[model samples]
Target: MARAFNAKVRQREFYPGNLVLRKVLHIALDFRGKFANKYDGPFVVREVFSGEAIILSDMDGTENALPVNADALKKYYP
Candidate 1:
């Protein structure tokens, strides 16, 4: 029962070192606001500070530091 609860809650919490690859992510500030005009490609979780995260793009060879929340991000499991 404990394991089941943990799995359910884990789906809601976003932590550092959480690997997110090849997904359409929306980066925003303060939870709700204007989004970045461009969609970034699959990025790796480099670091998570406070409410911000440092992600590295697969292409273009650039890194972006953006503020995001767990609820504000959705993983495309397709």
Candidate 2:
């Protein structure tokens, strides 16, 4: 099972200045509804930890107070 999973799993790496979108959780306080967009922000990646944690900043240069898991984000292309 581990081999099968690992075979398909590719590394997810993000660097500072990369654009990314955060996946919005349905249970989050600010979530609108099913019809709302699933992802939020073409936010900028401020820092990337060795672990799966990432720090993101808003387009206006304001950084988020907390670090988000890398799984919750995906690369954004303009």
Question: Which digits, one per residue and each the tens of the lDDT, describe model 1 over residues 51-72?
Answer: 4444443334455655444444
After TM-score superposition, what is the CA distance of residue 59 in candidate 1 from its true location, in Å? Answer: 5.1
Quantify all predictions' global Cα lDDT against the true fold.
0.46, 0.91
Model 2: per-residue lDDT, tens digit, 1-78? Answer: 999999998887899999999998777655455578889999999998888899999999999989999999999999
Predicted structure 2, TM vs. truth: 0.84
Would you estimate the TM-scores of all the predictions? 0.34, 0.84
Give the residue spans of candidate 1 off by over 4 A. 1-7, 11-18, 21-40, 52-56, 74-78
Query: What alpha-carbon RMSD in Å does predicted model 1 have with respect to the real structure?
Result: 7.8
